[model samples]
Target: MTLKSVIFDVDGTLADTEKEGHLWAFNRAFQLWNLPFRWGVPLYRELLNISGGKERLAYYLAQHPEYHPLSNDEIREIYRLKTNLFMERVRAGVVALRPGVRSLIGQCYQEGIPVGIATTTNYDNVETLLLRHFGVQWKHMFPVVVAGDEVPIKKPDPAVYVRCLEQLGVSASEAIAVEDSAVGLKAATGARISTIVTMNTWTYHHTFLGALAILTSLGTTQTPAYGTGPDGWGRYRVTVDQLRAWLV
Candidate 1:
């Protein structure tokens, strides 16, 4: 099947948004709220298993009922605050696109292959990052962006990826999803789309059972990716040509 589109996951897959972005924002929110809880790296890593930020917070709270009880509304407010903080950090240039990301996306655009984002991250956060990096017209660059709140269920469920494919008017077989974690891999594969796993500091340990390629990054020629498969491709510095070859 020919590759018609490339769907990317925002948080980790696009940039190291988890560690340098969201986690810090969440901690900052907690501090601002005087919540007495800080999501240290280890705890946050484990919490990442839970898809969305609000859901992660709720899950953590459920695990520790001894902490101050916050209603659903309160959780939403905290999350809103966290999202604001995240956007502020993004605008301040705290986050950066992963290696080869801009090159690959540009290549796809140049080739008329649509690029979409299927992420459990909030829509606004995605926009913030895109606008910060790709400028005000980022929406024109990424025509299809299906975010966390847009779907009833998040990753590991496939609803978001399915929605993204639908919006792009592309079939699962015609698109490739680039994901960072196991849940994301599950979501894309569950939708029957081929996926590429780009491991980051937080997601390096997650299983990527069905991914077409699992790499350290989307890698440039200067910093080539080191991974398990992509059989015929050099497996170093995944380029647009390599992706086209893989789709065959």
Candidate 2:
């Protein structure tokens, strides 16, 4: 079936903002709270495989309770602090939207295809990205946004997807989702939406067994092969033909 709407995940999928984006922000929060832990990119990747920033914080604490233990209130407070730091980094122009992001969204807009975001990030981050990438009024461009905390649950739960479908007024089959991780793939799959995966920093090695297609970027080549990595899945180039081949 032809796609009626397009849904996207914000972080690794839309932008390569994780370098100093997530890890450093978490560190900033950690320092402010005097929490004796510093998260690395590898650990951050594993954490992202779960869902929701708050959940990730909790999960990390649970896994390594000996390192630092923070109650739910404390976790929320620090994460809020982290969120602020992250937004500050993003606002300072430290991160950039991945390749083809602008063109793909433009294509969607020009073709009258509704674009929506189903992300685990807070609405503020989403809005910041919208303003930074599209324009200050970018939030007005899309009709639907489903954030992590907005719904009763997070990714892999399907609640957010269902909510997004409801807000967009589209059937699951009529919408397509773009994801960057296996957890995201599972979430969209659980929601019964066809998904296109774009491998990112830490997600480059995971299996995308059920994605309609997997690629490096939305604007590259229609059929991207294993480029220069040992895994043969590290690089890809997606094209309109490839996108149309799947979306159509």
Candidate 3:
């Protein structure tokens, strides 16, 4: 299909902001509050499966109540602190978009294909990155940014995708979703939009049953497959050349 638009997830898909930036911000907040709690990378990654920062903290509290001693309201306050710290880090230019993301976004613009960001991350966080990276007129570059807290449900629910389509004025069939995680794939699939799975650090090993194609990167023309599996059953690693051939 000649795609009309491409929607992306934020953290793992369009950027690598999670590992260092996100983790650091949360840790900073923990220290400031003198909370006897901290997250390992593994725990952080697992918590990411939860939607929002506040929600993640809530999940952690639920997982191990003996850890934080903070109530829901307290957790929310801590999240606000973390968000502020995250914004400070962002201002320091520590957080950034991932490899090929800026280039691919420019390419999509040149190709006249609408691009969007549909994420469970905060809107201000997305705006901060876009504003800092793309500068004054960044809003004109891309208009659709569907954030997690904006809707009643987050990823694996499809509310954001549905809202993004409405905002972009495109049908589900007119665009494609690119994502990095299995949870993300479920969200896109629930929206009934075709999805391309890009293997992130931790998601590559999980099943991507509904993905239209799975690629190492959004490289060049590669013929991708539908209904790929846990193994490489219906899937193959793609290259720029292969993508072109597979597009038909």
Per-prediction TM-score: 0.97, 0.89, 0.86
> Model-by-model lDDT, in order?
0.90, 0.79, 0.76
Cα error of candidate 1 at position 234, Å: 6.3
Q: Count steric clashes of candidate 3.
A: 10
Q: What is the lDDT, from 0 to 100, of the residue 211 in candidate 3?
A: 84
- Residues 54-122, model 2: lDDT tens digits: 888888888986885778999889889988888888888888887777777777787878888998888
Q: How many steric overlaps does candidate 2 have? A: 3
How accurate locally is residue 164 in candidate 3, as Cα lDDT from 0 to 100?
94
True lDDT of residue 229, candidate 1: 64
Ordered from best to worst lDDT, the candidate numbers read: 1, 2, 3
Tell me the spans in candidate 2 whose CA falls farther than 4 Å from its real position: 221-242
Error of 3 at 86 (Å): 1.4
Between which residue pairs do clashes occur in model 2?
A: 221-237, 221-238, 221-239
Residue-level error in angstroms, candidate 3, position 21: 1.1
Q: Write the per-residue lDDT of candidate 1 for residues 1-248, one digit (tens) a residue.
A: 78899999998999878777899999999999999789889999899999998899999999998998899999999999999999999999999999999999888888988899999998899999999989977887799999999999888899999999999999998998899899999999999998899998898988889899989998887888888666844556767787878886
Task: Estimate the TM-score for candidate 1.
Answer: 0.97
Give all candidate RMSDs, comma-separated: 1.2, 3.6, 4.1
User: Once superposed on the true structure, which residue ranges of model 1 sit more than 4 Å away at CA?
Assistant: 232-235
What is the Å distance of residue 8 in model 1 from its true position? Answer: 0.2
Clashes of 1: 0
